[model samples]
Target: LAPMLERTTSAVVNISTTGKVVVRDPFFNDPLFRRFFDVPRQRRERRISGLGSGVIFDADDGYIVTNSHVIDKAEDIVVTLENGQRFDATVIGKDPGADIAVIQVEADNLTEIPLGDSDDLRQGDFVVAIGNPFGLGQTVTSGIVSALGRSGLGIESYEDFIQTDASINPGNSGGALVNLRGELIGINTAIYGSGGNIGIGFAIPVNMAKQITAQLLEHGEVRRGRLGFVVQDLTPELAEAFGVAHKKGVVVARVEAKSPAQKAGVRVGDIIVSVNGREVENSAQVRNEIGLLRVGAQVQIEVLRNGKTRTLTASVGKQLKQTVSGKSLSDKLAGAKLSEAPEDPSRGTAAGIQVVKVEGRAASAGIRKGDIIISVNRKRVKTVSDMKAAIKKNPKTLLLNIQRQRQGLFILIR
Candidate 1:
């Protein structure tokens, strides 16, 4: 353990952060607010700190890898090596969908860890996790790989994680999950424990991290193709109803009127069993897989329709980027041709409200940015000017059928 610690601890770094942030009061006209408004507030924020661990992936010019959730939303980030030398780091690019990030620092002759093939790992393989757990500095604990090829946990958009019994805790996120040979097989990410190691842990597979990190560094974001179809998991009832031979592929819920799926001759009630040559186990898997394809990539698609298996080659379109990668990709959506709704209380937010206040029930209903309210409770939208007019024609709770870009869905907001 000492030799292992000595060999790798130099690459392990402690992250500290401080930032100047604005405090928005939920209430502005209250007496408490007025009393505090008279006092002069400092322009600079006080020292705020947090702890997490990272590994040196590239040491010559200083590149590191850690969990995106660790440094996400942080106003400032400072990294400290095992030698106590602190260097401020900048966020290069991050993918919340992947829970991985690449940070760069300046150093020479630094000992770095080599990434191990996560796909090569199996159950019962010895693993080690090192991190600044509980902020007590670098700590190392060992356990066996409890599971491999694990999926469907919904930990992130793309998950082929390696589950281990390794001791991962609060400060362990973004730490290195190394094999017995001290090679990094995965990034220590989530833990299912009672404030300590309960023999249940999860790590993002190294291959997934490598693919996303490389793409993010090159383009500042990742781009994938969109197959114009709404899909859901195959339930027992659905499986029986559809009479699918195997209940693994995603069942198409709906196809937009002018979507790529419709153009490609896809229809509702069609079971999308595979893409290219890979089998899709569920709807989320379908989304994740399709999202990995670049725009304009042509691929063979297999779908079960009318109890017959037919293969069709659909030309994939670029998916309007998801919000997880930040605003840099939003320009590819509409090129700044969007407008916000009026903020007057006369136009107070509604369940079917648009252009403002995306939180609450509507967003959970899966309403996303750039979606347009086509109808409220089946009432048709004639024009943008008639949205408020049409809303006044309906009741308090609205059942919005939204048209998001080329796809359509339902959003219930109040």
Candidate 2:
């Protein structure tokens, strides 16, 4: 039976993408001497390859399933089959927030693997992974399901990842995590190496892949409904801070003016308990569910406010999209952009800034897209208007207290 299962592994393939990008050695578009940033000359573009395994998702046309991060910036992507046929693969669709992407190899009669139900998977379920790990080609590793519904890594913007211990490594970014039947159950995404694997690897559940892939095939992008409310996870101190006996659900710290949350009567200090009928345990879950919902979805969200549970129906708006490198639509600072908060609870930070737009000075200030701006001139800016007003009033020569990477950064807005 094991040998028969081993035979099915041939459908799995390796993916590597190459691309060129412009990067500043010190800073970008600097006023002084105009810093020399490396631009993608097409000639200077490096072979930016990521080692990941993919399952032959379709028997016809040869669709491959892998992590979005693997081929995110690839100017050219190469897919290698188990039977040793390599082809130039085109990206059909990619969900950067979900960390999943679909690629296609132009071939027919390809051997493909079947997909298993991730919703039915349980902890301690045995699984196997086949991928190119550490540049080693087509390696198979095995372990058990460590946990389910894992989140809060900030790895992908939206996450409800399947946690496993299948010996996934850096090269295993987009491999297949299979059930005992050799059916693709998950796409290996991240390794929980606090230092090393400690028995934790994350995979994009097959169910999510199916939905996202369909969207990608339909639209070149993944779109989700955005609930415009700033939120924070409930800490013990926060529970005491809000005078709540239980540290349950995320607390609405701020709501964007005219946002769906504000429009639906959601407010600061409200504890969000459920969305679309599913209970929200933490901020990650909230982000996950919201991301899963289509844009313009009418979702029913429940919140605990003033010691009472109240439900509100909200029509979600389209979430702002960014590039794989994390560049948003606008730039608020030379380094940071600020906007309304999101439904995903994983948004709040220790310093606290609701990052909304990334553009202009923010993008030029060596700041990334989606960064939360917590303070301005040493004063905490809690609302979108606050940051905008402060920046507009102060002009140049201000310090921005930004939150990203779960840490605080003071950027100079000159």
Candidate 1 local lDDT, residue 209: 76
Per-prediction RMSD in angstroms?
A: 8.5, 5.3
Q: Compared with the true structure, what per-residue lDDT tens digits does model 2 show for residues 1-414?
A: 378466677888888777865444333344553435454322222345565677887878778878887886788888887778888999898877788888888987688888788878999999988888876788888889989988777676677888987787888888888888888889888887554456778998999888888788788778777877767788888878777787567888778788887888888889888887777778777777777778788989888877777999988887654322112322334334445443344743443455544434455565675576677777767665565566566655668777775767888856
Choose the strongest candidate by TM-score: 2
Off by over 4 Å in 2: 1-4, 23-47, 194-196, 229-279, 300-314, 320-344, 350-366, 379-398
Candidate 1 C-alpha lDDT tens digits along 335-365:
1122322211111222222432243223334
TM-score of 2: 0.77
CA-RMSD of model 2? 5.3
CA lDDT, every model vs. true structure: 0.69, 0.74
Highest lDDT scorer? 2
Model 1 TM-score, all chains together: 0.70
Worst 10 residues of 1 by lDDT: 342-351
